[model samples]
Target: MGSATVLTSSWFCVLAVLAVLGDAFLPFLPSGTLVVLAVLKTKETADAPFLLGLAVACASFLGDVLLLSLARRGAPFLRRRLARSPKTAASVRRVQRALENRTNRAAATVVIVARFVPGGRTVLDLAMGHLPERSRRFLHWSAVSAAVWAGYIVTLGWLNSHWFNTTWLSLAVSCAAATAISAAVARLVRRSRQLSVVAQLDEPVEAVEAA
Candidate 1:
Protein backbone atom coordinates (compact mmCIF):
# COMPACT_ATOMS: atom_id res chain seq x y z
CA MET A 1 0.00 0.00 0.00
CA GLY A 2 1.23 3.48 -0.85
CA SER A 3 1.82 6.05 1.90
CA ALA A 4 -0.95 8.26 0.50
CA THR A 5 -3.45 5.43 0.64
CA VAL A 6 -2.38 4.64 4.20
CA LEU A 7 -2.84 8.26 5.20
CA THR A 8 -6.25 8.48 3.61
CA SER A 9 -7.40 5.28 5.27
CA SER A 10 -6.26 6.61 8.65
CA TRP A 11 -8.33 9.73 8.17
CA PHE A 12 -11.34 7.67 7.14
CA CYS A 13 -10.91 5.41 10.15
CA VAL A 14 -10.86 8.42 12.48
CA LEU A 15 -13.97 9.81 10.85
CA ALA A 16 -15.70 6.44 11.11
CA VAL A 17 -15.01 6.30 14.85
CA LEU A 18 -16.32 9.82 15.40
CA ALA A 19 -19.48 9.21 13.37
CA VAL A 20 -20.16 5.94 15.16
CA LEU A 21 -19.61 7.61 18.53
CA GLY A 22 -22.08 10.35 17.66
CA ASP A 23 -24.67 7.86 16.42
CA ALA A 24 -24.58 5.95 19.70
CA PHE A 25 -26.40 8.72 21.59
CA LEU A 26 -27.77 10.65 18.62
CA PRO A 27 -29.30 8.17 16.23
CA PHE A 28 -30.22 10.83 13.70
CA LEU A 29 -26.63 11.13 12.53
CA PRO A 30 -25.71 9.31 9.31
CA SER A 31 -23.02 7.12 10.76
CA GLY A 32 -24.12 4.22 8.63
CA THR A 33 -23.62 6.35 5.56
CA LEU A 34 -20.09 7.26 6.54
CA VAL A 35 -19.19 3.65 7.27
CA VAL A 36 -20.63 2.57 3.94
CA LEU A 37 -18.54 5.09 2.12
CA ALA A 38 -15.49 4.10 4.07
CA VAL A 39 -15.97 0.49 3.04
CA LEU A 40 -16.30 1.57 -0.55
CA LYS A 41 -13.04 3.47 -0.28
CA THR A 42 -11.35 0.28 0.85
CA LYS A 43 -11.10 -0.81 -2.77
CA GLU A 44 -8.50 1.90 -3.31
CA THR A 45 -7.11 2.26 0.20
CA ALA A 46 -4.78 0.19 2.36
CA ASP A 47 -7.25 -0.50 5.19
CA ALA A 48 -9.36 -3.63 5.08
CA PRO A 49 -13.12 -3.18 5.25
CA PHE A 50 -13.48 -5.55 8.17
CA LEU A 51 -10.93 -3.57 10.16
CA LEU A 52 -12.99 -0.46 9.67
CA GLY A 53 -15.99 -2.36 11.00
CA LEU A 54 -14.03 -3.30 14.10
CA ALA A 55 -12.96 0.26 14.78
CA VAL A 56 -16.49 1.51 14.31
CA ALA A 57 -17.85 -1.25 16.52
CA CYS A 58 -15.37 -0.55 19.30
CA ALA A 59 -16.16 3.15 19.21
CA SER A 60 -19.85 2.32 19.31
CA PHE A 61 -19.25 -0.03 22.22
CA LEU A 62 -17.44 2.67 24.16
CA GLY A 63 -20.16 5.17 23.47
CA ASP A 64 -22.81 2.75 24.74
CA VAL A 65 -20.82 1.95 27.88
CA LEU A 66 -20.20 5.62 28.51
CA LEU A 67 -23.88 6.39 28.21
CA LEU A 68 -24.76 3.41 30.38
CA SER A 69 -22.37 4.70 33.03
CA LEU A 70 -23.96 8.14 32.95
CA ALA A 71 -27.43 6.66 33.27
CA ARG A 72 -26.34 4.46 36.12
CA ARG A 73 -24.89 7.35 38.06
CA GLY A 74 -27.72 9.73 37.31
CA ALA A 75 -30.69 7.45 36.95
CA PRO A 76 -33.34 9.84 38.23
CA PHE A 77 -32.23 12.78 36.06
CA LEU A 78 -31.71 10.67 32.94
CA ARG A 79 -35.07 8.98 33.31
CA ARG A 80 -36.86 12.32 33.26
CA ARG A 81 -34.88 13.45 30.22
CA LEU A 82 -35.47 10.23 28.27
CA ALA A 83 -39.19 10.23 28.92
CA ARG A 84 -39.66 13.35 26.82
CA SER A 85 -39.72 11.55 23.45
CA PRO A 86 -42.54 9.23 22.43
CA LYS A 87 -40.24 6.73 20.71
CA THR A 88 -37.72 6.68 23.52
CA ALA A 89 -40.46 6.73 26.11
CA ALA A 90 -42.01 3.65 24.54
CA SER A 91 -38.70 1.82 24.48
CA VAL A 92 -38.08 2.78 28.07
CA ARG A 93 -41.44 1.34 29.04
CA ARG A 94 -40.80 -1.90 27.20
CA VAL A 95 -37.31 -2.22 28.65
CA GLN A 96 -38.46 -1.48 32.16
CA ARG A 97 -41.18 -4.10 31.89
CA ALA A 98 -38.78 -6.71 30.60
CA LEU A 99 -36.14 -5.87 33.17
CA GLU A 100 -38.64 -6.04 35.98
CA ASN A 101 -39.63 -9.55 34.88
CA ARG A 102 -43.08 -8.37 33.84
CA THR A 103 -42.54 -9.32 30.19
CA ASN A 104 -42.17 -12.77 28.69
CA ARG A 105 -39.04 -11.88 26.73
CA ALA A 106 -35.60 -11.74 28.30
CA ALA A 107 -33.90 -8.43 29.06
CA ALA A 108 -30.75 -9.44 27.18
CA THR A 109 -32.76 -10.14 24.04
CA VAL A 110 -34.38 -6.72 24.25
CA VAL A 111 -31.07 -4.99 24.80
CA ILE A 112 -29.38 -6.74 21.91
CA VAL A 113 -32.26 -6.11 19.51
CA ALA A 114 -32.60 -2.46 20.47
CA ARG A 115 -29.21 -1.75 18.93
CA PHE A 116 -30.74 -1.80 15.44
CA VAL A 117 -33.85 0.24 16.17
CA PRO A 118 -32.82 3.90 16.13
CA GLY A 119 -33.49 5.77 19.37
CA GLY A 120 -34.27 2.40 20.90
CA ARG A 121 -30.65 1.88 21.97
CA THR A 122 -30.55 4.97 24.15
CA VAL A 123 -33.78 4.10 25.90
CA LEU A 124 -32.84 0.50 26.60
CA ASP A 125 -29.31 1.35 27.72
CA LEU A 126 -30.76 3.81 30.15
CA ALA A 127 -33.32 1.26 31.28
CA MET A 128 -30.60 -1.27 32.03
CA GLY A 129 -28.76 1.20 34.21
CA HIS A 130 -31.99 2.27 35.85
CA LEU A 131 -32.77 -1.34 36.59
CA PRO A 132 -29.24 -1.52 37.99
CA GLU A 133 -27.98 -4.56 36.13
CA ARG A 134 -24.40 -5.59 36.95
CA SER A 135 -21.65 -3.69 35.16
CA ARG A 136 -20.19 -6.95 33.90
CA ARG A 137 -23.47 -8.00 32.38
CA PHE A 138 -24.10 -4.62 30.78
CA LEU A 139 -20.66 -4.50 29.16
CA HIS A 140 -20.98 -8.04 27.92
CA TRP A 141 -24.27 -7.37 26.20
CA SER A 142 -23.14 -3.99 24.91
CA ALA A 143 -20.17 -5.62 23.20
CA VAL A 144 -22.37 -8.23 21.62
CA SER A 145 -24.86 -5.64 20.45
CA ALA A 146 -22.16 -3.43 18.98
CA ALA A 147 -20.47 -6.29 17.17
CA VAL A 148 -23.66 -7.68 15.71
CA TRP A 149 -25.01 -4.26 14.75
CA ALA A 150 -21.72 -3.31 13.12
CA GLY A 151 -21.64 -6.50 11.11
CA TYR A 152 -25.17 -5.97 9.84
CA ILE A 153 -24.48 -2.35 8.86
CA VAL A 154 -21.17 -3.16 7.19
CA THR A 155 -22.72 -6.04 5.33
CA LEU A 156 -25.33 -3.69 3.93
CA GLY A 157 -22.59 -1.33 2.77
CA TRP A 158 -20.61 -4.16 1.20
CA LEU A 159 -23.66 -5.25 -0.70
CA ASN A 160 -24.20 -1.73 -2.00
CA SER A 161 -20.64 -1.58 -3.26
CA HIS A 162 -21.41 -4.31 -5.75
CA TRP A 163 -24.30 -2.35 -7.24
CA PHE A 164 -22.66 1.08 -7.58
CA ASN A 165 -19.36 1.95 -9.21
CA THR A 166 -18.93 5.23 -7.33
CA THR A 167 -18.40 5.74 -3.62
CA TRP A 168 -20.91 8.57 -3.31
CA LEU A 169 -23.57 6.64 -5.16
CA SER A 170 -23.07 3.59 -3.00
CA LEU A 171 -23.17 5.72 0.11
CA ALA A 172 -26.40 7.37 -1.00
CA VAL A 173 -27.96 4.02 -1.78
CA SER A 174 -26.94 2.62 1.60
CA CYS A 175 -28.17 5.68 3.50
CA ALA A 176 -31.53 5.55 1.78
CA ALA A 177 -31.80 1.85 2.52
CA ALA A 178 -30.79 2.38 6.13
CA THR A 179 -33.29 5.19 6.59
CA ALA A 180 -36.06 3.04 5.15
CA ILE A 181 -35.22 0.17 7.47
CA SER A 182 -35.11 2.48 10.47
CA ALA A 183 -38.50 3.96 9.68
CA ALA A 184 -40.02 0.54 9.07
CA VAL A 185 -38.62 -0.85 12.32
CA ALA A 186 -39.86 2.17 14.24
CA ARG A 187 -43.34 1.79 12.77
CA LEU A 188 -43.46 -1.93 13.39
CA VAL A 189 -42.36 -1.54 16.99
CA ARG A 190 -44.85 1.23 17.59
CA ARG A 191 -47.70 -0.77 16.07
CA SER A 192 -46.82 -3.92 17.97
CA ARG A 193 -46.61 -2.06 21.25
CA GLN A 194 -50.03 -0.50 20.78
CA LEU A 195 -52.12 -2.82 18.59
CA SER A 196 -50.82 -6.38 18.89
CA VAL A 197 -52.92 -9.05 20.57
CA VAL A 198 -50.23 -9.75 23.13
CA ALA A 199 -50.20 -6.10 24.06
CA GLN A 200 -53.99 -6.15 24.48
CA LEU A 201 -53.95 -8.67 27.31
CA ASP A 202 -53.56 -5.71 29.63
CA GLU A 203 -53.35 -1.95 29.41
CA PRO A 204 -50.68 -1.10 26.82
CA VAL A 205 -48.11 1.06 28.52
CA GLU A 206 -47.07 2.90 25.36
CA ALA A 207 -50.64 3.51 24.25
CA VAL A 208 -51.67 4.85 27.64
CA GLU A 209 -48.59 7.05 27.81
CA ALA A 210 -49.21 8.41 24.32
CA ALA A 211 -52.77 9.27 25.22
Candidate 2:
Protein backbone atom coordinates (compact mmCIF):
# COMPACT_ATOMS: atom_id res chain seq x y z
CA MET A 1 0.00 0.00 0.00
CA GLY A 2 2.94 2.33 0.53
CA SER A 3 4.16 4.63 -2.28
CA ALA A 4 7.38 2.64 -2.53
CA THR A 5 5.56 -0.63 -3.18
CA VAL A 6 3.35 1.05 -5.78
CA LEU A 7 6.35 2.48 -7.61
CA THR A 8 8.27 -0.80 -7.62
CA SER A 9 5.33 -2.83 -8.94
CA SER A 10 4.53 -0.27 -11.61
CA TRP A 11 8.07 -0.21 -12.99
CA PHE A 12 8.40 -3.98 -12.86
CA CYS A 13 5.11 -4.53 -14.71
CA VAL A 14 6.22 -2.18 -17.47
CA LEU A 15 9.61 -3.88 -17.79
CA ALA A 16 8.00 -7.31 -17.92
CA VAL A 17 5.72 -6.16 -20.72
CA LEU A 18 8.60 -4.71 -22.73
CA ALA A 19 10.81 -7.76 -22.26
CA VAL A 20 8.12 -10.16 -23.43
CA LEU A 21 7.32 -8.05 -26.47
CA GLY A 22 10.98 -7.84 -27.42
CA ASP A 23 11.49 -11.59 -27.06
CA ALA A 24 8.77 -12.44 -29.59
CA PHE A 25 10.97 -11.26 -32.49
CA LEU A 26 14.41 -11.08 -30.93
CA PRO A 27 14.99 -14.39 -29.18
CA PHE A 28 18.36 -13.40 -27.78
CA LEU A 29 16.84 -10.76 -25.55
CA PRO A 30 16.65 -11.45 -21.81
CA SER A 31 12.89 -11.29 -21.42
CA GLY A 32 12.91 -14.38 -19.25
CA THR A 33 15.67 -12.77 -17.21
CA LEU A 34 13.54 -9.73 -16.64
CA VAL A 35 10.57 -11.86 -15.64
CA VAL A 36 12.66 -13.66 -13.06
CA LEU A 37 13.87 -10.33 -11.72
CA ALA A 38 10.30 -9.16 -11.43
CA VAL A 39 9.41 -12.31 -9.49
CA LEU A 40 12.24 -11.67 -7.08
CA LYS A 41 11.06 -8.12 -6.58
CA THR A 42 7.51 -9.24 -6.07
CA LYS A 43 8.65 -11.62 -3.35
CA GLU A 44 10.33 -8.75 -1.53
CA THR A 45 6.95 -7.06 -1.16
CA ALA A 46 4.57 -8.84 1.22
CA ASP A 47 1.34 -7.05 0.44
CA ALA A 48 1.37 -7.80 -3.26
CA PRO A 49 -0.48 -10.87 -4.45
CA PHE A 50 1.21 -13.66 -6.42
CA LEU A 51 0.22 -11.96 -9.63
CA LEU A 52 3.68 -11.65 -11.12
CA GLY A 53 3.54 -14.96 -12.98
CA LEU A 54 0.14 -14.26 -14.50
CA ALA A 55 1.17 -10.79 -15.54
CA VAL A 56 4.34 -12.02 -17.21
CA ALA A 57 2.45 -14.79 -18.98
CA CYS A 58 -0.09 -12.35 -20.32
CA ALA A 59 2.64 -10.05 -21.55
CA SER A 60 4.32 -12.91 -23.36
CA PHE A 61 1.06 -13.92 -25.04
CA LEU A 62 0.43 -10.37 -26.19
CA GLY A 63 3.93 -10.16 -27.63
CA ASP A 64 3.34 -13.25 -29.76
CA VAL A 65 0.00 -11.85 -30.86
CA LEU A 66 1.68 -8.65 -31.95
CA LEU A 67 4.18 -10.56 -34.04
CA LEU A 68 1.45 -12.74 -35.46
CA SER A 69 -0.47 -9.67 -36.52
CA LEU A 70 2.51 -8.21 -38.31
CA ALA A 71 3.24 -11.50 -40.01
CA ARG A 72 -0.33 -11.83 -41.20
CA ARG A 73 0.13 -8.45 -42.86
CA GLY A 74 3.07 -9.89 -44.91
CA ALA A 75 5.70 -8.17 -42.80
CA PRO A 76 8.04 -11.07 -42.03
CA PHE A 77 10.97 -8.87 -41.15
CA LEU A 78 11.83 -10.83 -38.02
CA ARG A 79 11.49 -14.26 -39.59
CA ARG A 80 13.62 -13.09 -42.45
CA ARG A 81 16.27 -11.93 -40.01
CA LEU A 82 16.56 -15.45 -38.62
CA ALA A 83 18.97 -17.84 -40.23
CA ARG A 84 17.71 -19.22 -43.53
CA SER A 85 19.47 -22.56 -43.65
CA PRO A 86 18.16 -25.97 -44.61
CA LYS A 87 17.40 -26.82 -40.99
CA THR A 88 15.73 -23.54 -40.10
CA ALA A 89 13.52 -23.92 -43.13
CA ALA A 90 12.88 -27.50 -42.08
CA SER A 91 11.93 -26.25 -38.68
CA VAL A 92 9.23 -24.24 -40.38
CA ARG A 93 8.00 -27.36 -42.17
CA ARG A 94 7.96 -29.22 -38.88
CA VAL A 95 5.67 -26.63 -37.38
CA GLN A 96 3.40 -26.65 -40.38
CA ARG A 97 3.21 -30.40 -40.25
CA ALA A 98 2.49 -30.25 -36.55
CA LEU A 99 -0.39 -27.86 -37.13
CA GLU A 100 -1.70 -29.86 -40.06
CA ASN A 101 -3.21 -32.36 -37.66
CA ARG A 102 -6.84 -31.84 -36.86
CA THR A 103 -6.17 -32.18 -33.14
CA ASN A 104 -4.50 -29.25 -31.40
CA ARG A 105 -2.35 -31.24 -28.95
CA ALA A 106 0.73 -31.64 -31.14
CA ALA A 107 0.67 -28.03 -32.25
CA ALA A 108 0.16 -26.86 -28.68
CA THR A 109 3.12 -28.87 -27.46
CA VAL A 110 5.38 -27.38 -30.11
CA VAL A 111 4.25 -23.83 -29.35
CA ILE A 112 4.74 -24.18 -25.60
CA VAL A 113 8.16 -25.82 -25.75
CA ALA A 114 9.40 -23.48 -28.48
CA ARG A 115 9.25 -20.66 -25.94
CA PHE A 116 11.91 -22.44 -23.92
CA VAL A 117 13.97 -23.20 -27.01
CA PRO A 118 16.14 -20.30 -28.14
CA GLY A 119 15.01 -18.91 -31.51
CA GLY A 120 12.37 -21.62 -31.79
CA ARG A 121 9.36 -19.57 -30.75
CA THR A 122 9.81 -17.04 -33.53
CA VAL A 123 10.11 -19.77 -36.11
CA LEU A 124 7.00 -21.55 -34.90
CA ASP A 125 4.93 -18.36 -34.72
CA LEU A 126 5.92 -17.41 -38.22
CA ALA A 127 5.10 -20.88 -39.46
CA MET A 128 1.68 -20.66 -37.93
CA GLY A 129 1.04 -17.30 -39.53
CA HIS A 130 2.43 -18.32 -42.90
CA LEU A 131 0.69 -21.65 -42.92
CA PRO A 132 -2.32 -19.47 -42.34
CA GLU A 133 -4.03 -21.10 -39.42
CA ARG A 134 -7.25 -19.44 -38.42
CA SER A 135 -6.62 -16.44 -36.22
CA ARG A 136 -8.72 -18.01 -33.47
CA ARG A 137 -6.69 -21.22 -33.55
CA PHE A 138 -3.40 -19.34 -33.37
CA LEU A 139 -4.60 -17.18 -30.49
CA HIS A 140 -5.73 -20.20 -28.50
CA TRP A 141 -2.42 -21.96 -28.95
CA SER A 142 -0.52 -18.75 -28.22
CA ALA A 143 -2.28 -18.39 -24.88
CA VAL A 144 -1.34 -21.90 -23.90
CA SER A 145 2.29 -21.39 -24.94
CA ALA A 146 2.66 -18.08 -23.10
CA ALA A 147 1.11 -19.39 -19.91
CA VAL A 148 3.40 -22.41 -19.75
CA TRP A 149 6.55 -20.47 -20.64
CA ALA A 150 5.92 -17.69 -18.12
CA GLY A 151 4.98 -20.14 -15.38
CA TYR A 152 8.18 -22.10 -15.89
CA ILE A 153 10.41 -19.02 -15.68
CA VAL A 154 8.51 -17.60 -12.72
CA THR A 155 8.71 -20.89 -10.87
CA LEU A 156 12.47 -21.07 -11.28
CA GLY A 157 12.92 -17.66 -9.68
CA TRP A 158 10.44 -18.39 -6.92
CA LEU A 159 12.15 -21.62 -5.98
CA ASN A 160 15.55 -19.97 -6.01
CA SER A 161 14.25 -17.20 -3.77
CA HIS A 162 13.69 -19.68 -0.97
CA TRP A 163 17.24 -21.02 -1.31
CA PHE A 164 19.14 -17.73 -1.41
CA ASN A 165 17.98 -14.83 0.68
CA THR A 166 20.19 -12.40 -1.20
CA THR A 167 18.25 -10.87 -4.04
CA TRP A 168 21.27 -10.35 -6.28
CA LEU A 169 22.52 -13.88 -5.85
CA SER A 170 19.11 -15.37 -6.51
CA LEU A 171 18.59 -13.27 -9.61
CA ALA A 172 22.00 -14.23 -10.96
CA VAL A 173 21.35 -17.94 -10.48
CA SER A 174 17.94 -17.76 -12.08
CA CYS A 175 19.27 -15.80 -15.02
CA ALA A 176 22.09 -18.28 -15.43
CA ALA A 177 19.66 -21.15 -15.51
CA ALA A 178 17.59 -19.37 -18.11
CA THR A 179 20.68 -18.76 -20.20
CA ALA A 180 21.71 -22.40 -19.97
CA ILE A 181 18.30 -23.50 -21.18
CA SER A 182 18.53 -21.12 -24.08
CA ALA A 183 21.92 -22.53 -25.05
CA ALA A 184 20.57 -26.05 -24.96
CA VAL A 185 17.67 -24.95 -27.10
CA ALA A 186 19.99 -23.43 -29.65
CA ARG A 187 21.93 -26.66 -29.79
CA LEU A 188 18.74 -28.63 -30.21
CA VAL A 189 17.67 -26.43 -33.07
CA ARG A 190 20.97 -27.11 -34.79
CA ARG A 191 20.62 -30.84 -34.31
CA SER A 192 17.09 -30.74 -35.65
CA ARG A 193 18.25 -28.97 -38.76
CA GLN A 194 20.92 -31.58 -39.31
CA LEU A 195 18.39 -34.39 -38.99
CA SER A 196 16.02 -32.72 -41.42
CA VAL A 197 18.74 -32.57 -44.06
CA VAL A 198 19.54 -36.22 -43.53
CA ALA A 199 15.90 -37.15 -43.92
CA GLN A 200 15.61 -35.21 -47.14
CA LEU A 201 18.74 -36.81 -48.53
CA ASP A 202 17.43 -40.30 -47.74
CA GLU A 203 14.02 -39.83 -49.34
CA PRO A 204 15.26 -39.97 -52.96
CA VAL A 205 17.52 -42.93 -52.25
CA GLU A 206 14.62 -44.84 -50.67
CA ALA A 207 12.41 -44.18 -53.69
CA VAL A 208 15.17 -45.32 -56.08
CA GLU A 209 15.68 -48.56 -54.12
CA ALA A 210 11.93 -49.28 -54.09
CA ALA A 211 11.52 -48.59 -57.79
TM-scores, all models, native as reference? 0.75, 0.73
Clashing pairs in 2: none
lDDT on C-alpha atoms for all candidate structures: 0.67, 0.66
lDDT of 2 by residue, 39-129 (tens): 7777767633257777777888887787677766766444454333446556556656656753555455556556666666666666676
TM-score of 2: 0.73
Name the candidate that leads on TM-score.
1
Rate residue 81 of model 2 by lDDT.
43
Q: Candidate 1: global Cα-lDDT?
A: 0.67
Q: Count of backbone clashes for each model?
A: 0, 0
Residue 179 in candidate 2 has what lDDT?
A: 82
Worst 10 residues of 1 by lDDT: 202-211
Cα RMSD for predicted model 1: 6.1
| Colliding pairs, model 1 | none
